[model samples]
Target: MQSKATTPTEYIHELPDDRKEVITKLRDTILSNLPEGFEETMNYGMLGYVVPHSKYPDGYHCDPKLPLPFINIASQKNHIGFYHMGIYSDPNLLEWFTTEYPKYVSGKLDMGKSCIRFKNMKKIPFELLGELASKMTAEQWIERYESVVKK
Candidate 1:
């Protein structure tokens, strides 16, 4: 769900009481596992981690005025959305996730190219999420993103 909250703290504060604990845990996991150069903030009404313009001056190809996005977390209408940009653009990464996720998950895995939606918090695989989040630094992500854009 698009949130009106402008800050991560505000976002957490406004989350539904029932959903608060899980989201907090997920947020903490993301922060703890996040790569060194990605800054966390609110973007597109979601919790966004981006490679700031100072790091990649070209900014996002889609929107040059904005920083390059690496990942996002959102509370949608009925589920939580976890996005991993690396998996979306790299076939190898996507394959790795598809191959490995089943070992940790038993419930239905509803996922898109970059988005994994979870209705039940218990269904989330924190270990996998942490691994994915920490796999690359902002510089590496920028190189990967640029390489794909060139292709």
Candidate 2:
């Protein structure tokens, strides 16, 4: 479910007790592993890690007012959703994550183009997710985003 909360802290606090811990952990994982130059903010009603306009003045093409979103974590209706733009934009990153997922979690990876759904909270691979978060820097994401958008 999309949160109406303004800040990440507020978003986590608004979640149900059952979801609060996991989402908090996921937020922490992303924050701890994310490379420099990315800022944490609420984007699209989720806890978003973005390339702020200070780093990329053009902002997101879809809406120039919003920052370049790199990653986002949200508490969904039935599952926790982790969205990573790098995995969606880069085939090699997608292949790497898909190949490595089975090694970390027992169940099949439930994923969309950019969103990874974790139905079972206990099995969420925080470590692997952290690695994925660290894979792309803000500069790299700006380059990748421009490549796809400018095409």
Candidate 3:
């Protein structure tokens, strides 16, 4: 669900009690492992980890006024959604995540191009997600983003 909350803290506080802990842990996992250049903010009505304007002045290609988004977490209608741009844009990263997913999660991966859905919150692999978050840095993401967008 899209949250109207303006800040990450507010967003978490607005979630249903059942979801608060999972989202908090997910947010914590991402924050603890993400590279130094990414800044946390509320984006697209979700908790977002972005490469801020200070680090990449050009901002997002779709909307230069906003910072470049790298990752986002949200509580969807029926699942918790974790969106990672790196895994979506980079084929090798996608392959790696797909291959490694089974090691951490017993059930088949429920995923879209960039969004991974966790229906059974108990099965969410925070460590693997953290590792995924750590896989790419802001500079690498910018380079990857530019390459794909420029293509």
Candidate 4:
């Protein structure tokens, strides 16, 4: 999997037709609410956004080029996954998501290590998801991701 994100627009252009529509809407929500230092790119064969090097030379845990805290919108054989770094990186955020998601959604939204999987985009709460995306700095996010994954 590649580690760098090319450009937000280009990333969307690369998605397959069925995935493109959902991911583009998801991408737009994220871009609209991005924190100061975030950037968009293509990594792991998916569209991703990260905290750029300018904000922190060593992004999110001192790994400058690592894709530690990113959102990966993927089109899998069975479903789509809206991977939010915040889900792995923040206890508070994760708790909130689990609690509130069901209240707002009527369909399936599966999760695993920050990856929010949904077979249909109709199930996602795009605005709430976007707000969560804008919540933390890459460094803080890395701390959360590492805390969970490193164990």
TM-scores for candidates 1 onward, in order: 0.94, 0.97, 0.97, 0.77
Compute the lDDT of residue 1 as modeled in candidate 4.
30
Candidate 2: misplaced stretches above 4 Å? none
> What is the per-residue lDDT of model 3 for residues 1-151, given as tens digits with 9 covering 90 to 100?
6789999999999989999999999999999999899999999999999999999999998888999999999999999999999998999999999999999989889999999999999999999999999999999999999998534
lDDT of 2 by residue, 37-76 (tens): 9999999999999999999988898898999999999999
Kindly list the per-residue Cα lDDT of model 1 for residues 1-71, writing each as its tens digit: 58999899899899888778777878888899998999998878988999998888998887788888888
Ranking by lDDT: 3, 2, 1, 4
What's the lDDT for all of these models?
0.87, 0.93, 0.95, 0.70
Q: Quick one: best lDDT, which candidate?
A: 3
- Candidate 4 differs from the real structure by a C-alpha RMSD in angstroms, to one decimal, of 3.5
| Candidate achieving higher lDDT, 2 or 3 | 3
Per-residue accuracy of model 4 over 7-75 as CA lDDT, tens digit each: 656655666777678878888888888776667776566777775566545554545466445677766
